[model samples]
Target: MPLQKTLLALEALDSAYVNGESVKQLFGAYPRVTVDVMTVQGEKGSTDFVKVVVPGSEGKRSGGQAPTMGIVGRLGGIGARPSRIGLVSDADGAVAAIAAALKLADMQTKGDTMKGDVIVTTHICPDAPTLPHEPVDFMDSPVDILQMNEHEVLPEMEAILSIDTTKGNRVINHKGIAISPTVKEGYILRVSEDLLRIMEMTTGQLPVTFPVTMQDITPYGNDLYHINSILQPAVATHAPVVGVAVTAQSAVPGCGTGASHEVDIASAVRFAVETAKEFTAGICSFYNESEYDRILGLYGSMRVLQTAGAQTTPAV
Candidate 1:
């Protein structure tokens, strides 16, 4: 089947699975509760970026309890190239079908791109169950509670500060999460609502505008969630042939259990896509010398297929 057709079919399957009265009612009342698929073109050597901050006094006290080591503070960020494929759905069944179709398409078009046969999949979920029942809040920035110590410094404000050197001088590591001056809490909520609306639509829907400004963290915590949104590719295959590649943005920290499941799924997809892209690139490079024009011809043919509606797999 054509790639577009396959996607439509998968979407139909998802709709059917979610069509029960209970699900319909739930969706009608709270459409944001649904799951959505987001896909990106598979690429090789993709990685998940993590930034950490440890806490300690800036001045080294000659006599004090030795500073504690080990990940005092850790934060994750998403890392991905500009090109990718994705789908979104609240229905687990639609997600499954979309995943299957993506897997099949990757299998069929393995060598078409620089990434080998790979389909990167990611699912966004909430960070904590106790905070809210909404699943789409995965993209939201929660109000951080400030806990101060005797010195008035946030006691466990471990999210922003890290200590590197312990012996003489304390090396404080500070990474900023950029916040937009114009965007307010209300604006953020509206963006989330817009995303929910898009999620209810078809599979290939792309966000008209990305609300998050910078991909990197800034001086404040505003960009924390944005940085964490980086997506990595996951690799899944049978035997010698890679089956699926999953990729997604970085996940939030200290979220509840339900949100963790979504993080795992997204991580798995990122790994798959990265693996496939790397493997394919290596294979193509190795064989290019012998095949020469022939390899180029194959690539051209695949491009045409992709353009002509063939279910082209991702490039390895």
Candidate 2:
């Protein structure tokens, strides 16, 4: 089960001094996994971007042509210290992403490597600033969205599973994990049935899906209201992106303390791990290529939505 991995990630992140080096050490035992840590500075502060690469047997890293899947633990920060204490709700995405990486590393050690490579990226920030928002405050990241996309959204990733704690909104009222529709370029395609089947098989419950708007899929810093940063990766790459959301029955602030639920985070971890397995093996399809081609041929391209539209007013 992912319980152990989730616990391990939670323990690693619930620290005032947690950084990329400390996180890298956790994967030293798995030689097949390579971990890198780079410090990125933003206007407000700095944080370490921790990237974990688990090369699969037939994956591109090994000279094979198997597709690569990116699993990004998208979040503002793990903690909003000085102003708040302890691991906040925003930490769930990082926890889930790291936990999934740990689990994949362990599987590799046990001769359970998949067919494609998995690239996992997340930041380590113990103390970050908090920002004012509508229903609840957000845990501001040390780096802004552009910086985050530059570091996390690597071109090698053909498709991405962007996991984030989506409990800060009233739109999605679920207790476990929910998935979003396939977002590619600028179109909000239908939810992948294969993903739904996998989610049902993994959780043994109905697959829960959250909504996404045109503005939500666009890049951040656009002054538009987003459900959260769950879909930020979509704006940075042409890859088909899906959001794995750790949810709650009620709204919770991103900076709220002691609001992280291990079970819920574990659920997201499991979902991501399963998706990685299927996606890498070419057994899962995020969207039908022929159907997508038909749409493009009929209506033309919708790439404009990926950018901040022709300037009318600056984003505040």
Candidate 3:
């Protein structure tokens, strides 16, 4: 069901010259869906940051009262290029995010519009560099984490689902998709039952979840060992962030070609789309307001964790 859109996005990204304009054209047919692309320059190179908005009938973009939900496709790059031949494993997050955006656009045309606007953000880079890591190599982005957060983590987003390829690690051995616990203001909260339920319905199997450590939620460039950049958005926003990881049983390098699986990526797409439906309708919540308030009152603000610690190097 979601494959049609997923494959469409894959075809769009599996190119040597893919850019913001090329991706923006995908939504030109839909009058309600608005797509925006900005080309940003970084140290290594540049990448196109793309945002697609699927407006809901009562969404705030139209001056309505409904909340806005954000879906960020977090990845370093779609391809390692010359060093790699084709679409690499890191590309799955972007594919799934774009596919979800396309599906939402199609749904709006067919009278399936949601109650609130859905904003999806992701960057496209055909050829990105690779960084050495412990278990495997990572798909290094053209921009640093700060640049990525600045473009992708919009303040308008009330809640965010960060989708990324989390395969280049020893943890999360499942071959399908996995979700991380709700992370907010440097606190790693319990897994959302609502999200788990949606995952079960979408995947038709038990919900799979990955672990998040204190260091994982902190900003990168601290010289700490993070699982990956899957939860990097958490460090940039006060909004509750959840990571939707495209995983594998083995430690697969992010730069490894021929490792992307369409079906598994589709599974993540389904989960995100369903969560958007429920989240906007007031039927699903990422974190409990009262519980979070209680924790905050008892422990004070944990927002310091959002910043680079004292005497740390400038954020790369």
What's the CA RMSD for each of the models? 24.2, 1.8, 2.4
Clash list (residue pairs), candidate 3: none
Residue-wise lDDT of candidate 1 within 1-316, one digit each (tens)?
A: 2234334433432321222232223223222123222211112221111111111222012232322111111111011112111222111212322333243344334433322222222221212121221222221212221110111112221111111101110111111111111121111112222222322232233322222332211212232332222110000100111111112133222221121223223222222223233333332111123343454455432222111133457599
| Per-prediction TM-score to the true structure, in the order listed | 0.21, 0.98, 0.98
What TM-score does candidate 2 reach?
A: 0.98
Off by over 4 Å in 2: 313-316
Question: Model 3 off-target regions past 4 Å?
Answer: 312-316
lDDT of 3 by residue, 112-187 (tens): 9999999999999999999998799999999999999998999989999999999988878899999999999989
Candidate 2 global CA lDDT score: 0.92
Superior by lDDT: candidate 1 or candidate 2: 2
Instruction: After the best TM-score superposition of candidate 2, give how far the Cα of residue 96 lies from its true spot, in angstroms.
Output: 0.7
At residue 265, candidate 3 shows an lDDT of: 94
**Residue-by-residue lDDT tens digits, candidate 2, 202-277:** 8999889999998899888778898889999998899999999999999899999999999889988998899899
Report the lDDT of model 3 for residue 60.
91
Model 1 quality (TM-score): 0.21
Q: lDDT for every model?
A: 0.22, 0.92, 0.93
**RMSD to native, candidate 1:** 24.2
